[model samples]
Target: MGTAQAATLAASLSRIVADPNDMVSLSDVLRQRQLIARMIEASQGEAPLQQVLNGAVHTAAQGCPAPMAKILEIDRTDDTLVLKSQCGMPAGAIGRTAGKAVEGNPAGEALKNAEPVIDIDVRRRPPESLPDILKDNNVVTSVSLPLINHDGPYGILEVDFPEPTQIGAFHISFLAVVAGVLADNIEKIHARAALIVERDAKAVLLREQQHRIRNNFQLIIAMVQRSVLQTTDDGCRKNLRDIERRVFAMASLYDHLLGLSVQAERADLGRYLSAMAASFDDFYALRTSGIALKIELQFGIDVDLDTCTTVGTIVNELVANSVEHAFGGSEGQITVSMTREADDLCAVTISDNGHGLPAAALESTGLRTVRLMLNGIGGRLDVQTAPERGVKWSILFSDTPPRKRGAAKP
Candidate 1:
């Protein structure tokens, strides 16, 4: 052949080789775009950790024909890599652990150097140098990338082929991108888990503090009762007893708040009202013997701490008055009921089957205190009393309203 003919032949061969290289470059670009799109979709998913791992492995395996794709996270406790998620690997190999030695393992080497490592032929390596899991699975070629970010090395991504396969620079580049996405997702999941732990700790602490406060209030009640017994004057003794009852009423509110399953700024009115009634029954039995007192309580709404306390105080005064004067030291029954009136309004009624109130209403100190408490909490009081029959007191209140008094019952 002449010199001109040989030169022409060389140029044609050069073009032939360049065409496949061009095609391979185009294929890599498309694979990179696909991996990026999958990452974005995975990030938007509800389960961040699962989505990230699955996306990383699926994307890597799709780009390269690998029989198995796995993600191994660094277990900082023991300084080893543990398999976290995998595709096409036996279930037993899911949690397999490997030491941090870079001598024979491609994953360890990649993580140690914060780079990508590819082994085209693993069968040639010494049996001792191969990981038992990989060898058992008959893996012939593998590519590993370190999941490193600004926070440093986190884990490793590995794709294993069952048969001898060649991995190019473009394939390694795709795996590197997948590793970066997985690293970011892992950090976010860890941060969220830490936040949940901190929140639970705070809740436990708050419950303990509330328990202590209730105990302290109980001590105060005991001291007041002691003072009541020590006083010689009838008036002074009665006043001390009243004070004790009011303190007990407040303590009941705290107990009801603590019993709730969920922590909130408000207390349940129904539970608070029921507890207060039970406490009053016990107190009545202890103070006055041989007198039967039956209390019927019904609740239908909930209120906040401040509102519950005010309402409880009012109920305490009303019940005490009925026990002291309504039955005139005889057997009687009292019914305490609460119901929701509107979207934000509620009504509570306390009634007794005994002699009714006197013609003049709001005559005693206890009644006056009830009226004041109701006013303070933006509530209204209504009294229905009949001579020689019975008395019923209904209180209407709103969740959010201006403090005011309603018309007196005639």
Candidate 2:
């Protein structure tokens, strides 16, 4: 053959070797002799994996002139060949089995030897040796090809004729090639499915680890709270209480991260703030000294874990500062609001209806800690204060793009 003709023949054979679906057009007997040399040169290429094996069987059957064609997968659990796909076969024959023994039936025989088994005249064979499905369908001649991959035998492909007819060696060889391609594609698809299953298993394991870590933090916070209750010195007790609240804030952040449906790289800012506010309210409620305190929280954005942690610390410091210094041994109210201003910007306002901060209060260690926390999240803090009027702290920061409005609520 000319170089150009040889190349075209090689490409066609490669397509046939890679995909059983391409075999329907490859069974032309007149072209077989001329293409045999090119077929030998065709390299095995990767076939696109299919979700279902029945489609491969149906495609292969379309090329044959036989009266019936079917594919049966080996059921290793029971050592039976269960029919998976079929064309021109009885409805009840689709899922029928070829029994437990591999000696009698053509499908079982082909799978046992990893080769083709041809019965040209089934009537001449012993009646017990014939498959019930085939005998009932009046099949006279049948050819079964084992579908074998690198992993060994998996299934069998069978074609049946109503009348006894001679099948050439070339035709049987072509069918074997089709079976090999189909088996290869099935193996690749099975491998991919196994990988996905393994990945999901690992994700479950990681989530369990995160849950344990959150539980450990809760235990630590409980121990700290017990320490606070045991202290006799008023100053020491107050310091220990502050330590417990800080640890609680860290614990709450972890709880939110673990509860998220997606990866825990970010958190719902509104939800986290609300949770922190609730924790503080519960802690301070027990120290009732006729100080009626009301805390209002409104949130409208989400932030990454780093930003969430920094903002959470800032809130912890600022809110605690307000509770200790804003109310001068009297009843007061604190309102915390978070709103998304734009795609990448958000503002948080924490205000109180109590005695406002003096100029010296801004220079305190608590306010300095809040400033440092804001800086870490690439945020700016602004304080509006006046004596006896009250104090409002406004913090504006860059945030992730806003989620759909009704998607998450605080």
For model 2, how does the per-residue alpha-carbon lDDT over 8-119 read when each residue is reduced to its tens digit? 2232233222334433344375454334333333323433443245544554455455778888888888888887778787676667886543787777887786667778
Per-residue lDDT of candidate 1, residues 1-410 (tens digit): 32322322232122222224534667668867876786767676445687678777878787775779998877877767888888888777778875453667777776776656678887787777677778877888987777754456667789999988977655665565566556666666777889889988998898898899899889999998888888899999888888877888878887887887546756668778887777775776724634444544445465666788888888887777788788887677777888777887788888888889997766766677677777767777889999878899998887653333343332
Instruction: Identify the runs in model 2 with alpha carbons over 4 angstroms from their true place.
Output: 1-51, 65-67, 92-94, 117-124, 164-185, 196-200, 232-239, 262-264, 286-300, 363-376, 401-410
Error of 1 at 211 (Å): 2.4
Q: What is the TM-score of each candidate against the true structure?
A: 0.77, 0.72
RMSD of 2: 8.4
Of candidate 2, the 10-residue stretch with the lowest lDDT total is: 401-410
Best by lDDT: 1
Q: Looking at candidate 1, what is the lDDT of residue 361?
A: 60
